[model samples]
Target chain A: MEISYRDMITVLHGMGFGVLFMLAFSGAIGVIYATTVVGPQWPRSQWDNAMFRFYLISMAALAWLATISGAYIIYPWYRAVPPAGTTDLSAYPRALLLSSPRTAGWHDIGMEWKEHIAWFTPIAMTMVAYVFIKYGPRLALHRQMRNAVLGFTAVAFFSTAVAGLFGAFLNKYAPVRGGPDIVLMQEK
Target chain B: MSAEHQPIGLPTGPGAAAILAAGIGSLALGVFSFAGDAVPAINRAFIFWQPSGALSGVTITAIVIWLVSWFGLSRRWAGRDVALGTVNVAAFVMLVVALLLTFPPFMDLLQEI
Candidate 1:
């Protein structure tokens, strides 16, 4: 059976939404733990310091993973893949192109594309790591870096979820008849 | 209860060993998964050669790591016991996610579309 873009969009949406929801909940838990449990009781203790360090490192890893994964998800369609067959242009035409069946296999998973995005991930991750390493604490001077870590974590996760949902919807769009045509074809 | 009876930092009994084993296996699997995807020879050797390196590489590594750590460093790393647990959990997640992302789930998802 020939799957349409809408079908693909649904999958992306469901999986993306599910994972994002989980990450957001986990992030909330981390925040709560940091503020109430670790922040109040163990902030000054050696154990707390160690735990904090571990938590920060984990967060950094997570940030890097999400950033790269997000890029991987959207980049092929966005940069290399031409517009499928749609005309409603917006921020992400490739995703919009999902409305067109013609663009299904149009994605260019070439070496240049892979290298370009893949390399960005490590660099971004390293930068984040360096900041934490150099000035994870000392909020008086490095408040910006600390916030950047937190900010990247929050924003990347949120965007990933939203984009993933859009991706899901894009997967749902049909090339021939959009949504109605598929239903008719199914009925036939 | 006496202080002597409290659970120590090290994993004990069959339970700890199981988790330790699983965790190490997961990490090893993760490393191999990435390696296998990146390298054709390594991938071919493990995937097609004796024992199917892709299948058993992680499990074997996990068992070895678990045994060594359980017997050797379990006691030494008592104070930092939590880190051990965290490492295991992270390893487990990494193994599953890496495998899923690489071979079937994510790849299949894209292919289906």
Candidate 2:
């Protein structure tokens, strides 16, 4: 079945939200692991190793998905212009556009920073996964790798927070249309 | 605690501190090179990529440095000594200098004088 632009937006939005939620949950677990379990004095069980691997892999996958979905939602704003001629601009959310004076504020600076930092997430997380897989079973070496993983997760968390802030601002000012038009837009 | 009771991971000494410092330092340097107003050359120099791409390039470069230092130094020396040694000290100093140079007040002062 054909989907409308608005429907596509909604789908992308839902996917983005899901990814962000997963990132936050995994990131919290990562933070706990970094603080409590990464060092020499922490208990080392097979379960600990398993959990660490699970968390790192999940985080990396979720982050990469988030990056792609976020790009779809945000990149259009970089070149957003009002619909031309008789074409209806009402279907588009004005707040998504950086060009919109209504939505422009200091938050734009934060958004700009967020965009750049977001690029780092997938790369860093992938590296963490590589280091872990390549140097597993070496407890001392794993601890060092854990430190790097923690750093990468921290960056991911910060970027997600900034994206959420921007999302909230857009929702407040320029809520998108719901239902059939969304379906129709996506089909076109 | 006995040998078995002692954890087999990284120590909570200089080694861990060094790793943390290097990571944070690299992040700060990335931010400074991209977001700070002081580095206009970075923006103009990259012809192939957009300004944002250039910023990412700089940030990635810093991350590479941090990763290399963390792995190379840690492998060469014991964790605690690596943390306390000249390499960690150098990383920390580099972070400090990057912060100072990119700080808005510092950039403003430089522009004025």
Candidate 3:
């Protein structure tokens, strides 16, 4: 089961879209939770609180996975060059074939920030979720913790949006070479 | 005011400040250690690993600081006085700084100036 770079990009693109959709859905749910449950001092059932916790955990996991996988696939510079003895170049796209470092374009810079900032998302989200679980029940019950959780979630949402934007730019401006166009052997 | 509504325990005050300082300091070390040609010896030592190693070092330091601070300070503090506000604000600032350091324009500017 060999997969070409083009196929990888296609699969990744689909996965990215799915992650974006999930983020949006989760963000909406978060807003609802903040406004209706947290704001109104509504008596939340155990199941309701559990569902919110689950949503937070899911969003964190999805954001972590998406950011890591996206960075790995989108940044060709991070990859190691093939061994000197091997001549196969068909597996990689031209954009990834650079022998020298290229000047950092705006998109590249955006990705740099995105990649580093994304490292905090999982930790921040997990902390918020942990606080919710430890405290238990209505957000109104724990005002300070609720504010902190809301702040962290807001940052998480921002980071996810930025990552999606960077991915879109990379896909549009730095596309992978098609399978048919890849040369099986490179000239030394 | 109920037991169930009490804040979760976390490091606070000096403990949290220490952890935050260590984390940010490690991150700064990582960024500056890899930037430019100022330290040829350090670069040569990390020739195979370079910036990745430096970055990982920062993360590792942060984790250690967090764990140590949690154990050392979390038990000492009462729930409501946890000072989570301070920790959260510091963490947020550190996150922003980390991002800014990695931003392309910042990196370019640092190189030029």
A3-114: candidate 1 lDDT, tens digit per residue: 4453344334335433544354464335423543333332456565456556555644554454444344433334333356745544344444544566543322221122
Which candidate wins on TM-score?
A: 3
DockQ of all models, two decimals each: 0.02, 0.14, 0.27
Candidate 3 lDDT by residue in tens digits, A128-159: 55555555454455455566566656665665
TM-scores for the candidates: 0.30, 0.54, 0.64
DockQ of 3: 0.27
Tens digit per residue, CA lDDT, model 3, B14-39: 33333344335434533643252234
- Candidate 1 TM-score for chain A: 0.39
Give TM-scores of the second chain, every candidate. 0.44, 0.52, 0.46
Per-candidate Cα lDDT values, in order, are 0.39, 0.49, 0.50
The DockQ-derived docking category for candidate 1 is incorrect
Candidate 2: pairs in clash = A3-A186, A3-A187, A4-A183, A4-A185, A4-A186, A4-A187, A5-A185, A5-A186, A7-A182
- Model 1, stretches more than 4 Å misplaced? A1-44, A66-130, A140-153, A174-188, B1-113
True-vs-predicted CA distance for residue A4, candidate 3, Å: 3.6
Better of 2 and 3 by lDDT: 3
Per-residue lDDT, model 2, residue A125, is 58
List, residue by residue over B27-85, the lDDT tens digit for candidate 1: 45445545555567875765432422333343344335545654554455433323323
Off by over 4 Å in 2: A1-48, A68-73, A80-102, A119-156, A171-188, B1-25, B28-41, B50-81, B84-113
